[model samples]
Target: MIRDKIRELLKKNAEAETNFSLEKPERAEFGDYAANLALVLAKERKENPRKIAEDLIGKIKGNREADIFEKIEIAGPGFINFFLNKDAVLEEFKKLSKLKTLLKFKTPKSKIQIEFISVNPTGELHIGHGRGAFYGEALSQVLKLTDYKVEKEYFINDSKESSQIKELGKTVLDEGTSYLTENLKSQISKLKTKIKNLKLEKPKNLYGEAGYLIAEEIQKDNKKFIEKELGIKFNNWISEEKNLRQKNYFNKILEILKNKNLVYKKQGAFWLKTSQFGDDEDRVIVRTSGEPTYFLSDIAYHFQKIERGYKKIIEIWGADHQGHQKRLFAVKKALDWQVDMEILISQVVTIKKGEEIKKMSKRKGEVILLKDLLAEVGKDAARWFYLQKSLDTHMEFDIELAKKREEKNPVYYVQYGHARMASILRKAKSGKISPPATFTFAEDAEILLIKKILEVFDVLEDAIKDYQVHRILSYIYELVYVFSVFYRDIRVLDSKQERERLFLVKETKKILANLLRLIGVAAPERM
Candidate 1:
């Protein structure tokens, strides 16, 4: 909020020739915050930029709000840097402790829908999907914290197209187009024989398509199994085919586009003039066979979001789907809707088994399922591992590291700090010990750790405001690193300053709990 006030001042003082932007200084000595208004003005004014910066600093000094700035200094090349006193930092902490009281700042809220992990139901979730799920879920939480009305959703593909995909699987297995065909005879025979051998009820005569059906049944079993095993659940499971076919929304949108001359007939198919909106080429909305293209259904689905009255719609997609963005943007522009759509791209995942890296393939039965990873490492560690990195970076998942029982895992390191705090609190409660009314922030490491704790709100605000989950992860790691150094030299329950140290530990746990909750991770009191 103070930052907003400072921005207003800069805007008021800015001339037609000048613009100012706040930038984080590379080093604290340069100043806590810096701007380059002078550099932006010099070209138009044809005067020395440093002189302009000095004049601005003098003007800033006379303003009443100038108390917010402890010192304003002109740095190299006309960079004006401002430093705030310790009170400014503490004020942020006080405000954060009462963050709920700050919601009045955001008014006239709009509904937002965030759909993530819309992974097809053909197979179990893998590490690749996990990134999107964790990141998207965390982002939704951050959005809610910022006072945005948010709805979390998942779009499941369980329709005629899904049936078509099942048919493809069935066809690969020599099943019938609608029923199981002959190619899957052997698997069917094997299943029957195994069922009979186990003294179970006899399986049906349908071989190929029946076999594929059986396979799908087994995969659904895996889905449920994996969900419980991985502790992942969705708020909604939307069947795309059913939704698309039920209301004929796709045809309606196509007709509207056709009427508006946005759709053109070509080669017995329909195409959208997507190239007009920066797309490399026009996209086909319908195939020659009269079947709607995936793009058509996607456009219809996005329209559904707009119709649902969600002012903002966010979709988390894998990197391979980046090309799809242009077409989606084209449709948005074509409709002239005021909706905001954001697509987060997640990088590929590499799975490692000890020193060996293996290719992941679902058809070849070599892919590592999310269930398998959770089973090996467990839900807490599994979730934390994925949340530790930026979604844009290619993540290397080493099974060995994940399966470790020691404190080598970053999650454990953070959780240990929490559990240690819990242990201290439990003992203190048992002995009826009380913390000091006034705690001292004197030790170098203690001061550093406390200052970092005070910055938790800032980190969360930055991550939410900028959509940078990596920044939050970085903040967590920094806090842990600082606390680790402090823990090495300080003891909480046994030290002479036990009460104050215990209080610090309690504060750390509370902050860590909040961080873990925001990222959809559980902070266990005992691990």
Candidate 2:
């Protein structure tokens, strides 16, 4: 938000549509914040950037917002560095009447639908699914802060025609054991009588019916586990079989494509001219054997998402599905997808302990379950570990580090910072936190702590720009690092500055709790 104000001032002074960089300086002595407006202007005017920077600094000093800055200096190559007045920055934070006034930021209403972790109903959720699960949850939390109406949905791959459900049927009917884990065996055991009735009812394709029954039970248990144990929730549970096929969406889309002359028959198979819409090649929508390809069902499902009126749709999928993204984008172009659609591929995760790396061999049915991981290292640590890295990077979960209870573990260190702040507030017998009308103290440590707290807003704004939830987690770590330095250098309890320091501690606690909530992690009063 402060960055926006700074940009507005730069634009007003430049007297033209402007684009410039404003960010924190790499080193502390450079200043609290730095910008490159002078360099951008120099490019246009063909003038010395240092001279432009000096003139711009004078203009900024004339504006009312200039009062918030303690010093505005022109640095190397016309980079403008801004140092904020401690009292002015604190006043900006204090004007908010309540925590929500600052925390629940408002933006223009935009309807968004985020879909992730749509695993088949064949087995328990693996550690691979954990990435998308926490990623989607954290993404929804940040979106809500910016006043986006985000619908977190899970698509159930329960279509009887799906190869997975068919294979699961063989396991259910005792014909073969595929994806037959102990938990799935329990589900099959519970549905034995129904499986028997299905055997008696439809002898020809009993695998499909039997698979459907067991899949329903498995999905029920999976949903319950997400709610109770993992603390994740979904707004909708859309089924591939019930929601798309039962409604005849696939058939309708086929008709729409055919009428538009986008479909043609070649070599006894129905082909879609996907290459015309920017795909690398044409693709088959239906096989020569008269079975629809997976692409047909995907088209139908996305069409429904568009019909439901989401202005923005985001899919967080596993790395294995990355190859399908270009074709999906082609489909969007062919069908004139009006909304903003993005697909993020979360790379593979491997468990690491010291020197050895344990990668999942799902083909051999050797995998780690998400629930099991949570049981091994508590839920907060599990969630934090799942989201520590960017989605594009292959995550190596350091189990040994995550298991540590000391300051070496980043999550533990952050949570400990919140606990220490809470302890400081409790020592002062503070009531519900309220920002004072003004901050009368000015110390290097205290001012730096406030700057870190303000960066919380910057991190959230960045996440909204790119939907990168990891930014929020990263900022909490830096915030705690700054808090540790502040608490170590300055005395808060039984000191001359007890009153002002207590106020700082209480504000830090609130800031930590808000950021932790955004990342779907717990902020403990005591650890």
TM-score for each of the candidates: 0.82, 0.95
Model 2 ranges with Cα > 4 A deviation = 41-48, 96-102, 429-437
What is the per-residue lDDT of model 2 for residues 1-527, given as tens digits with 9 covering 90 to 100?
67778878888987868778888787988887899989999999999999999888888899987887889888999999988877767765564324653456677688899999888888789899999988888888888887778899999988887767888899998999888888888888888888888888876557777788888888888898888987888999999999998889889999999998999999999999899998999999988977678888899999999999988999999999988988889989998989999999999999987899989988887799888888888888989988989989999999889999999999999999999887788878445645555577678888888877877777777788888788778888998999999999998888876777787887778888878877878888997
What's the lDDT of the predicted structure labeled candidate 2? 0.85
The lDDT values for all models are 0.69, 0.85
What digit string (tens of lDDT, one per residue) describes model 1 on residues 185-238? 444455664434433333332232333444554446545764566454656556
TM-score of 1: 0.82
How many pairs collide in each candidate, listed in order?
A: 7, 0
Q: Which residue runs does candidate 1 get wrong by more than 4 Å?
A: 1-31, 34-49, 64-72, 87-108, 161-166, 176-227, 361-365, 405-408, 427-440, 487-501
Residue 460 lDDT in candidate 1: 64
Worst 10 residues of 1 by lDDT: 202-211
